[model samples]
Target: MVRQTLTKHPWWKIGVIYQIYPRSFQDSDADGVGDLAGIEARLDYLANFGIDAIWLSPIYPSPMADFGYDVADYCDIDPMFGDLDAFDRLLDGVHSRGLKLLLDFVPNHSSDQHPWFIESRSSRESPKRDWYIWRDPLPGGGPPNNWISDFGGSSWQWDAATGQYYLHAFLKEQPDLNWRNPDLREAMMAVLRFWFDRGVDGFRIDVLWHIVKDVAFRNNPINPMWTPNVTERDRLIQRYSTDQPEAHEITAEFRALADSYGDRVLVGEICLPNDRLACWYGTEDHPQVHLPFNFQLMETAWDAVTLRKTISDYEASLPSFGWPNWVIGSHDAPRIAAKIGEAQARIAAMLLLTLRGTPTLYQGDEIGIGEVQIPPNRVRDPQDLRQPDLGIGRDRSRTPIPWNSSAQAGFSTVEPWLPLNEDWRERNVAAQDQDDNSILSLYRSLLALRRSHNALSIGDLTLVDAADDVLAYRRQRANEILLIALNLSDEPRPLLLPENTCIAKVLCSTKPIRPISSTLDPNEGLVLELKEKS
Candidate 1:
């Protein structure tokens, strides 16, 4: 039996995405913050990174309460990140360089300081009061329900000034919008149109699953496996609070808006189980999110059996003709190197880039950058500040990319907002960019190979084997075929090449030496041209 997979429809469907956190990417002014001009200054550097698109984290007008994730003005850029003019130039640079730009759209919520929220909370009689989800206090004067915030407290914040409570799945300072409101939907759609009109490519919609809370506003059921060690938000299953039925309709609306302007893309951030996650793809004829940001690699264990099982299951679970994407690292999670150790990080990289779907790489992971331990006094993440004991902060992974071996790692002139450790200085880009065996070089090689190979870019994936601490797969496009063998362990593992399959040539390897054989060295991987025996 042959299983037909979804063919590529757009460049984004087949290309790689690079994510940059503006505040930490590069500081052109030496003001301890990265800005649009800084990003423009480094356009050539990023343009050469072999990525098809750049997904910039929120740069909108903000109060910095939750960094840029708490967007205040959707239509303008923040002063710290440069104004709208700077943004226009950056967009132009991205387009002029023949690269795409994906803005981080924070539509799930807006900063409470925004004018709409300000008016919404002014009084019960405010015309814009219903623009945000507001519920009166219980008869006894507590929260309206048990909804919890992602930042470690109650999701419903009591607003004494308004004599009611407002819902916020994240921080109290960022209230959830009333997505059910027709006016609010039109306003958000208009914001999207505003950016698309300015030549922006698309958006990486943040927390797409969190939109459209349950209309009834019921309390979330308690998780049967809740433990004292986990954060409070995880205590509940979040059935009614998130991933509600209305979300799909909202997703379709978003899809319609993006479709109106042909050639635009929409990559949503969704973290869900395979079954629930597959629904985001919409119908076979009508697609919702172009790429529903796959993060299974980042969330799953790095072992061979685990990776093979999840990858196969996810692939099989996709809707007919549904495209898949993968991400091994992100700003909110620990660096892949830190989670899986340095040796396995290389294997993870090969799997991410060579997989059947699109791959998104974090800024500094290309150089094998590990998590930076934030000192207690230097910690600034709201997650860390609110719940220091939970160990879920993001500052460690959000450190600036080390551009050189000099002080500040060439990321800034003065001391950066976050300190760079000795590892950053040693593994800086300037040092590894010239070394053929360095992680950066390996990344470049893999990306180049994938880009040039038709089998790798738009091909069908078939699982070959998952055993002996090695996971193997085959990617085929027409007559072209390539075998990807990954050693998840440090000790040597005999690669189980598919029956009648032989290695014609070695495409690339993670280890220093490339062997045109079946046996894989410790923590090594190879993409080889496969030829059948005569």
Candidate 2:
């Protein structure tokens, strides 16, 4: 068994968090697109599963260029998702179920169609022209810098009318804001205050580390192992465009706004690897984001040692200011069930919840949903069509949720915005609702177990032993001690237990297990409660 420990904090103790990608979650009107009302109507199901909060991916008004990530209006709801009243209802519904709601805040960029950007681009002398990053072309008619967009091609989009190239790290339609401009920063803060004043619980900031760019607009060096077709931005080292020092300052401002409300939180999405990722939490003088979404579980290789090392390294690297978090699935990545196979998805979920940090669950993962195989002819994402060799087919993971066996998978009267998976008839919420052994049921039980025991909620993570494919750990807080063990292979493995302790099998993804007499079968996982001798 490998041992680890965590500092006890309020937000870090959250039991279970559910991520809702608005477009594919549900459709309230037969329009075949999900709206805020759709989520409100489904609140009971989420609450029933014992989820503590729901992270709603960007729902702000957008042109649908990059779904809702390209914000046209930071304060208003998009017609595709619904109006203000619908979101108000959503908050009421979520709160009624004892759950909190988190909105996606895209602070790094705004849609070119946004009012501020439109005015900025209309003329050089416009008041809002400073809102975006615009620079003149080099002498040879090339871009001023060699920054590459995350979606491929040059990060600069040349504007013929102004004879300048505007910086856009993602899409040309979404212009990167000039964080060096204090006016723009103040405006973004006002937007956050506006939402908070309206009672928003918190925000899950999008690409929070990409807020500031290298001041000199210098060219990024070519990566030694750079390959054009593999990653979206692998051609360059991205030294000048991401994870700038000003990012921490911006995050501190965001955290302060959210901290105004005692229970509010801010979760940042920093995609960099773990070594430098922990710095986003800020230093002792200021607190950065509440929970920086750690993607180690999603990025780690599917091996016992790799996963164990990732978790252990994160625990060791966490700064004294902010809490640690773990995410196995999200909107932009493939489903966890598909990544590790259906049998192992439950085990992954078990480990995520039983571990030391806050756990985030992507929507539709509870019932063993995998990434759908979308054919090239039916591909919808521009990224997939634009760069076929990249194999960044996200539509496979963004398919509409399978609520029931009904036509359209109970998602809409018309065809969904994205195609529903063909296997939805058999693998859906309706079918799993009645089966205790189903993944959804297992998730519900896991949430209940985590909440009922303080040890599981906010306890220290101490690895007892780790050998081959078997790993064991203890979660302790005061008198409660919870030992979690996993048999990560097909063959049976013997696990060493704590001496003079009575083992009580509290939860397991497979068959009911006892500590000594019962052996964990292949892909079997367990959470055992321990009682010390008098």
Candidate 3:
């Protein structure tokens, strides 16, 4: 693991991050695909949109096998997304508005089309032969072991020339890099430095936990608790193939590299539970990711009691130096509006922004974007394309953002890569920007409140027993004491405050800011100034 650098600047803890799925974010070229120029044109929109940072998903040159997750070249931009000149201009525009830009880094693997992998696969005596994971087939002429791919197949792909198989955790076109190779590790580190030199603020590392694997090449055991109804990839436990101890050392190296750039952050995408997830923070002396992406909110049940337990447990379990983060929706999951209905999504906005730590808002959740149905032929996600009956496609959540009611929803002149929602005209940025009661306005108000109030941004949290259907927490930093009460049920729930305590005033609410009340209307939440009795 890497050593600590005395003190750290807490931009991640202090600000909100917005994830932009590049292809669906904005298409300026009108070529049915989004590009850096598109994002550059919209810098003012994001700045006024109230986010502190914009994390762009994989803009590296790729063949788009996994929608840019498969990196063919790390040091340059894809022609489809414009050239390096476009990226530099985008960076300049972002900093001009006092906002940060974080690029997505995929350290675990590279596209098969990458020169390093191509050379490594050419012959056994190639200079870069050891740069990738390649092994001889089993004695019985099967895969090296029983390991499975995330995209529903064997992780090994046979190479015709080398007479060996290479490991690919996802698509066969994406080869896993050999992190154990010192030369390979240095090369990847150089890629990080290359981007840092270009003035990018941070990175959101993709699939961080699966980067390393077992040395013995042992078969993973069958999952005892897995059900047939679950994803096919979960049929076997990933204990042996994933979450190796060496992964921490690799991440620490990344942390050290990022710290060298001064104030740049490393956000890891790890989907493990809280206890196991804590390891990514490293021990007290050495640290790993600045913020291991917290996906608990996306996975938790939509209710007061459930979310309360989740937040409390996560907060308590954090390592001493580790800071927490929250994600409501993302390119991978269903949007919040569709998950629990639009009304509850407003309460969700209050819950996300008012929480103690930093929050990440998905691109479209602010305007209450729901799921868009994709027909069989139009589906782009490989998961659904592979298993059409499972109904687990991710394309619905990743539809193009509806800016206006114009043709292509103002995203493109031509048809978008993914279809826009049918309600794009009714539920759009142009429509919501004017409506004070719109979800977009609620998000802005929450962000403004968060920025204006020190207590909400950096404060101690104390959970109160408001009611079974209501969630209440007090945040206090010195004299700035406030209470947040959320009604999670469809019916009105009375706010049951503790003894000798009363709300001074309601600062904000799902409906409207009003006088302190004993009960919250159905699906409403209140941020209140609190007063304690003598």
Candidate 4:
């Protein structure tokens, strides 16, 4: 019997999202890797943080080539992470706390170990031969195109047995799917339904923009000035390879599928500028995604001026069909705590929770966990495997979470899958939970304040004049207006206040904001409320 699942609508407005990288988050089996049970046991901790949902990274059947990104099976949880029953139990627990479960959907490619890819590469006339992109060798015997992999080297890999080149935008072992094929589209949707039926809330579509490519096999133009940081693939403009016009339609299809399930949401990882980023939201009549993960704040230099400009730019560029969101840290980049320092991580958390959008807090960022220092011999990321000199491994941010001050920081009974940070004694969750002034406590207070005030969550944002090292903005809902000011520099700084509004009270401050204070100390930021002058 075919079970029809309906779409879930307006799912983003309810609460804060906490991202969990399951493999590094916890390990119940003490196998050195985190599993679903580990996360299940920690639900109470997350629920206490005022998080409305959990966005778990891929736990699907995989060879761990990309740490679950290269999925071998979309419908089943990997044995390393536990079975389907464990995932079901985790979902049940999350729901019991009124929390939603968002899973990572690697729509761009599949591990070569996947049955579809294995069958696709078996023979030229195999039944599933066209499931993945395959091309004949160029007239001169090299790859058919000049496209390069994001991980490094040519994007096309030749299968000696098949005498054809296959497309892999990432690691060679992960082949790009042929999304241009309708059969493949239906099959992928079936994977989505498999989870939807399992009571999952939604998905964080990984590398969503790379899902489709130009079918013409055209060569991409070369960049005029290729920075060393730019990948060999990024040397080209990516004109034909990404941001395809058809992507919007595909997103709409996904939106429609998610809509088939009541209140399910779609959040896409769109790496683009504000203007281009807003386009993924679909046309006014039909919305592509509830929120396209906004990384502008994460990439921008941490400064009042830069942050103010980014906020204004993103707000101005938001499409009518979509909502705005802000992400300061994620598993792929440097930790925010490391990026801005411990004091600044607290300030950033304050700013994140108080902002007017759904906020996503990366797993370890709450406790101010900085990036771990991994030596050359221990790097596990594919990016580092390809370019060691660049110091680009994301595993620095993927270090195991410090649950408590125990052997292996209470994450595992034995040595962890990755080296434990030597400083876990000071950074463990137990230490922070007991300290009233800790980052974890600050996050709790900030989230609670935001949840208590609708003006902070869904209100309209208005920028105010703030001097260098100071950022000031107002969030307004109906007649209630809340003004927030942050001093982003060391030592004290003065900010220009809006006219006609008397200072009602200081909503939040890293340190006490002195009356008529002109400067905020290093790492200090504050939220102020304005009173209507009688």
lDDT of each candidate versus the true structure: 0.87, 0.83, 0.89, 0.85
Alpha-carbon runs more than 4 Å astray in model 2: 1-12, 499-502, 512-518
Q: Candidate 4 residues 1-534, lDDT tens each? A: 111221232447747888999989889997999999999999999988888889999999999889999999999989999999999899999999878999999998999999999999999999788889999998878998888788888899989999999999999889999898889999998999999988999999999988889879799898898898656667888878888988889899899889889889888998988888898888877779878899887899988888888888888898655677888888898999888888778778878887778899998888888868887788889888888777778998899999899889999998888876668998889998998778888888788777666688777888888778888888887787887877788766765678777777777776544664545666687777777878
Full-model lDDT, candidate 4: 0.85
Pick out the ten consecutive residues of candidate 3 with the lowest summed lDDT: 1-10
Local lDDT at 470 for model 4: 82
Tens digits of lDDT, candidate 2, 1-534: 111233345543554678999989889898989889889888888877888889999999999788888899999999888899888888888888778888899999999999999999888888988899999999888999888898889999998877789999998988999988999999999999888877778889999989999889889998889765587588789888998987888788888877777778888999887767888877867888878889888888876777778778889898865567888888888888888887788788888888887899998888889868887777877678778877787887789998999888887778898877778999999999988888888888788887777687777888777557876789998988888888778788776677778676555554444445546677778888888766
Pairs of residues clashing in candidate 1: 148-155, 149-155
Model 1: residues with Cα > 4 Å off, grouped in runs:
1-8
| Candidate 2 lDDT | 0.83
Task: Please report the TM-score between candidate 1 and the true structure.
Answer: 0.97
Which is the leading candidate under lDDT?
3
Tens digits of lDDT, candidate 1, 355-455: 99889999888888876888998898998899889888899888887899887888899988887755876788889988999888888888888777878
Please provide the root mean square deviation of candidate 3 (C-alpha atoms, Å): 3.4
TM-scores of the models, in the order given: 0.97, 0.96, 0.97, 0.96
Q: Which residue pairs does candidate 2 place in steric collision?
A: 1-464, 1-465, 1-466, 2-463, 2-465, 3-462, 3-463, 4-461, 4-462, 4-463
What does the lDDT read for residue 239 in candidate 2? 87
